[model samples]
Target: MSANPFSLQSLSRTEAAVDPAFVFDGTMVSRAEFSEKVERTAAWLAAQGIGKGDVVAVWLVNRIEWIALLFAAARIGAVVAAVNTRYRSAEVAHLLKLSGAKLMVVEAAFRAIDFAAILADIARSEVPALQKLAVVGADAVPAHWPSVRFDAFDKPYPPAPTTQEDVDLPVLLYTTSGTTKGPKLVAHSQRTLATHAASVAQALKLDPQRHFLLAMLPFCGTFGMTSLLGFIAAGATIHALDAFEAAPALKILSENRITHSFGSDEMFRRILSLTDAPRPFPHLEICGFAAFQPGWRELAAEAEARGMKLFGLYGSSEVQALFSIACPSDAFADRIEGGGWPMSPDAKVRVRDTETGQLVAAGVSGEIEISAPSRFLGYFNNPEATHEAITADGFFRTGDVGRLRGDNVFVYETRAGDAMRLGGFLVAPGEIEDELKACTGVADAQVVAVDLKGNARCVAFVIPASEPPQQDKLFARLRERLAGYKVPARIYVVDAFPVTDSANGVKIQRARLRTMAMERIAAE
Candidate 1:
């Protein structure tokens, strides 16, 4: 981490021949073994007519193939368009065409997921730029999209290509979404990812020796992929999992003594409830939590009390994951709040008042902007959007609301759009949601603000816990626990919240909730 010894081109090459690099199920893959795969996969990409700057869409889970293909594509100076396996027909088709992918490598079959069948539904006319489609776990290939069954290695690893490698070469294209009609493809160069990986490893205190890491998250998202790269930069042994399941993840973490891992609060809470030991994760060093769901505070407190070091994290596809880590040498409460110091030493953060459009003073919340080494080059094929997102001074205007804590340290509050201006004062919906959740019979809650005839009003959507929560009791609790203005204008009980899947994880569609709230109010 002090000096990143591994880059995209030299990833598995620098390690000792017999050094353990990846472990899957009960098998271990040595650096030499993995390096051979990288070479073979590089040759495969070349054989498929993929060249420099071309895109190779990967529609697979977290496995050795996913990792190998990433380095392989980098070896050939091509970009890897990491596609989330959870994506369906339309999403898959959109991403494939959006990236204009030259080749797509996917798992033919994973669990009950029939990837080949899904791809069959997509017409070849949609992805005309695609030259090849390779699938693992099966031998047969579709007629419209031909393949040699990627894992067979029918052809030998051709001589290493004569292409060149540079730190600024585009090597990654991650699919991300905002309030746009379609998802944006985030572009990143070799230098940005390598540098961030090294910085994160150094900040998190990872070592190749004795630090066994788990690839629990999917490789399609920056959150999981960046963690994998951090493992590579640290040269630590990786336990690659195809997908995440609480029962299996617990077994792997406990049996392998995984030193570091990262995931959402809901994921960790499930693991916590299922484990019987007082010190469930005794050997865990630092488990980063995203605080993605309700009850995160309780989950964080319980995890720390069990001897596990759980720290908060903040990052996005544009910045790559682990952009800002709250793992400073501070108290647990402070450290577990996301947006501490930038992982990159050269990075700086500033806050700008939404209304004034000027930099804010210490402890005042505003839009958080960052200038960092790991900042993305731009959104792929979206020049207008890119120009709008980056400021003149080169800071990425992160649409996230946060505050500067006086010393280059910062505290990320919420997404600027999600931050509500209730009663003429800015407030975080999490406060209201948490209050509503603490009420009897409330399983989960989401808060949103809508403009009603000339006034902004806060409203809530709740997922009930078995029995629907009574609005009278919910209002009573909100009045007892929070300010009067912060109380939600109404609450609607439902079986589940609206969600959309991404590489990161399942995210509640807050925008959709706002629309629903507006309609509900209009009908009043």
Candidate 2:
């Protein structure tokens, strides 16, 4: 096994060959077998005209095939563009066009959503670069298009030559949840990802003896993918689930004696809410979580009583997943503080004044800026956005407000813009606003995030063009156009919006609207 951690081949070689790498739906795959599958998949992709810099979009749920495709694409120097499985036709079309994907691997259907039908809605002209579509979990390809089954890649093909320099080039493209604007394509190189993975494994104390349970979180996002790769680098066994159902997840945790896992605060709450009786996991050791709310302290204490150490984690797609994590030796208060010390010694963290661009005193909240070796390269095909995000001195502005307590510990505040974290995903109110405004009888719409029992919920205020739009009809329209999570929970019809004077012009006061929403929800 090699010590060099620059490429996928080197990382896989570090793991024990006979160790179990993945256990998906009751089938365990050894590290050696996993490596061989990656090599064979890479060769098949290369035979299909995928080469260095080509984009291969993977649109599947948490499965062994999804993980194999990610590594296989990197092995052949092709970039893997992960498409969120919850995306509708409109969202899927935008990502396909933006990534310029040469090949797409998708599931036949998931949770009763017809993926083939959604793809059929997209015109060929919208994604001219997408040459082929491979359907997974299907007996045969549908007759609507020239598609093939995912298992058709059994024949061997010659592999492409890869170099260390090639490993430094972008090999993965992940979409941001889109806070202020539409989702941007974040590009990450193999070297950057591998370095971050090793750092995360060390911080989390993962090893060959650990068994990790992965559920709910999609591999398309940085959080899940980083954890997946980190566990793989540590030679740990991964137990995967198609979705996050409380009953099934609890059963997996207890039956498998899972040692580690990651999830949002809400996910843990739902699991705990499943029963009044204590669900014990004697082997459970550590669990990393983010987006912690006030109620999480009780849940953390309960999990601790059950022998599980739950800690806070903070990171983003632009920062290569986790730059900060709580150490096991830290105090219980510090562990729940949302952001901990930097995971890597080379990573630098600072809180700077939003207006002056100067470093602020410790304990003072400001924009969180970071300079790290494992940071993402830049946004794909969008140099202007990249330039705006990265500073002149190489620090990336995280768009998050936070403060350093002392030495290295940091506390997270809120987003600088009007973004909100809902169900463990960052979402931009603008996207939902656009959909609402397009509905019949809607003249204008403004969306804001309101705190409801420690959970961020979208509340939309709309001005009708004529008669007020039927709430049920409007919601149905939104359901068809956007993901279910993006739909607003409550809608309020307003005659006009409250505006505030700004330097540029009058702006809608989202903060005021948020207050109004809280009061309204309370009254209801």
Candidate 3:
């Protein structure tokens, strides 16, 4: 057995101990076979003189080759930069330059996008840092750059010994949502991410028998990579997807016998819609969700109706998987009403009064802070951001509002990031959305502050059920749950939110919806 303490290399090590003939993507890539492949890739990479601390950017989608590349990077102590496959030329170029990647692995054609053309454009640009580029699943190398096919590179190579620290910097950076700047790079060491995976795997009770169907992107983002690493660390199988679509996902779930899955609240909604037509994915035992907007019960009921239990998960890019609400017992409900139940092991979470910066009572609403070992190292190349996001005591300022319930559970209310003043009072969109979610016929709700006559007004967007949701009924419900001033001044009963594609099952991108709302209001 290898002496490595905490690298993804342990994936093969553990799998070898259990079932070596595990089915990974139809073919049975045994532990011995998988280890040999990883070694071959590592040896090929080492031949290129790519050693410790080198950055290798993977520009492909979810595939066996990608996993090979990732493990290879881990073995050689190279930082793996999982490039977002959705990026266009400009976005791709920016990440390549920012990550300072020395090698890139891509395919000839990905869906409709031409990787060769994009590389050609990038090579023409001023980014002279990139040295080698390999094309996977391609026959001929493009004239723009020297390349080898992914299969041709596969060779019989012996596995090399590596240390616990050898995998320390396997993952270099995370691609943010680009709300303020161009996707600020959130950096993490392998130890940090491995710690995160340990927590997540423990929470899910993942083992070799646990098969998870991944319904998100395959990038360096926390949501994506965490799913990959967490499953791998648990010696489990992960069914990958290029993207999430409801109908196809349902089909895959049923056919693959996928037991566990997760997505944003929007994703659950889409899965619910599929079951609404015909019962889809009856085999799914557990499903997790994060709400960009509140009102998960409808989707939960839909999943339950289809034989799947739904659980709420609260996490962020800074902290991979913070906490989860699996059971809606008194403790869970009370925690949700307050904010969220603390679900992390040894993760110090507290709600601090915004005014005093002092820890608040269990039920009091305050800024949520977390101190955990798995916390991200820092934002890449941005010390000011690192300082601003974390405190002197090492507690990461989550910018979320919540409270704790005793020592075990933590409850969250709203995000400190979205706090805006309205009529000389602080307004929280989550409060408004939660109230709207309680409204009859309102399947889901999301609220954002919009400037009206120089004063912020709550703009509530709702997704109604099959029946036409009565606007008057919803307004009355909000009146009961919220203050008159806090009630959304303007309500829009949208058939579906444009930002959050609930049809796909994930958090609704509020930034996209905010822009759409502004455009629609202007048109009116």
Candidate 4:
């Protein structure tokens, strides 16, 4: 591989040279037009005095303009701090503050979200680092807010491509989904982003000639952003949606002959359940999904019975998404697993026993660790956390429990925190959750272990298919299928489970469920 591919400007230009770079917001953006936007956006960044090492905040949904900002920041050697559109005032404030973003470019209004009002909630002095506000989707800046329109109509590109030509300089920051201690900004340079994209394109076996991917995932997260980068790296065209909806998205996937795309299991289930369109989406060859919400049936098997091809995916903000993926040729049993062979040929995956603190052999469940090219430089401005995450031997402790197959691949299981000890046995909650799903009318199940009177016991939260199931019936079914220890101590019915969005996808907030489960048990 040539070092030429690692250049962000070169990659931008190469991708922009394609006939139609993107179909977004109901209009086709030509290659030349896309290139011009990159130049214009880069020029605007220069005019704003956003030079090397400065952070430019992006707070919008999936749009071509968002992609343009990414290229623009990379071109000017500035770092882009992406803010999730789903975030509210406090979350948004924290991200802007954590990244020390000097300029924030956000849409004035988006659907039901009053972005301007959210901005109003934070006083001018709230984020001291934010110097200027660049508003999109508005004709003029409001009186109270000192801001400029994100209009780069007649701006000129800088005389030179960059003041700093190093691709190793940080160019993007993805915020990690944190709990007790808030989110950490995960920084990645042009080299890592470019190399990882190229490696993923190869691993996915993408060809610009025929393969086209639907950009349904939100670009604020790693899963969405990495897929976008992979498409650009492969010189493939993308059809992007500003916002993802099931009906519209399904229509696009069916009509466009989409060959490769990535999303979550929830997204696919919704699309598949929308309408009986004679098994629609025939051309969808590679639909990589993260099992954010664990289900009873193997989604891949179910999807394959239809025309669509589905496979599991594994990645996080720290290592970046698509670090590993299930191959298209993998059997459904293997395809349903979260972990897969690394996209980078040089990437190393190993397991370390959490209790023994020693590397584990194949088929032994332990912490999944990786030494890969896709790994982030470190948690930005948080050296202590970064030090604790990566081992001295260079492997990143993924904080995920998994077992390596004898081959080069591995299988990701539940999170280390989510794994529970039930009746003196270390157990995966999914095991009990699956059995719970087998009960009559059980749509889904979330099992959590609650410490009850010094003994760890399993508690289940279930969403019904049409109506809540009989608690005694569900418990009886689990008792018949699983061992006495594996059965949930009690089962509770609910309309839906609670979930939170992260760098991965929409994940069920197990901690919240655990709290609810304990309360329910105590009240009984």
On TM-score, who's better, 1 or 3?
Answer: 1
On residues 1-524, what C-alpha lDDT tens digit does candidate 1 reach at each position?
A: 11223357544443422258888877888777777788888888787778798898988888788887888877778899988888777788889898999888888787887777788888899889877778777765563677757862446856447576765867899887644576889999888888788788777777677787878888889989888888877788888777887888898888887888888877787777888798977778878878776677877888888877778878999898888777547688887888887788898889998888899888988899989989999988889989999999999999999889867789888999899987877788887887787888999899999987788889999999988788898888888888888988888987888887655566788899999999888888
**Order of models, best lDDT first:** 4, 1, 2, 3
lDDT of 1: 0.81
What TM-score should be assigned to candidate 3? 0.83
Q: lDDT per model, in order?
A: 0.81, 0.77, 0.66, 0.82
TM-score of each: 0.93, 0.78, 0.83, 0.93
Which pairs of residues have clashing backbones in candidate 2? Answer: none
Query: Over the stretch 1-524, how does candidate 2's per-residue lDDT look in tens digits?
Result: 22356876666765342267787778888887787788778777777788888999999888878888878887767899988877778878888899999899888888887887888789888888998888887754553447767773465667645533477888889988644456889999888888888877777666675556554566888878887888777777778777666787777876886887777776776776675655477777667787433245667888776566787878888996667877788888788656787777789888887767789888777788998877999999999999999999999999987888876678776577666666665565656886887888888888888877777779899999887799999999988998777888899999988874311123567778998998999999
Looking at model 4, residue 134 earns an lDDT score of 87
Q: What is the lDDT of residue 465 in candidate 2?
A: 85
Q: Taking the tens digit of each residue's C-alpha lDDT, what string does model 4 give over 139-181? A: 6445234688888745464542445467888889998876676
Give lDDT tens digits, candidate 3, residues 418-461: 66455656566776776777666777788877776666777788
Each candidate's number of clashing pairs is: 0, 0, 14, 0
Cα lDDT for residue 294, candidate 4: 72
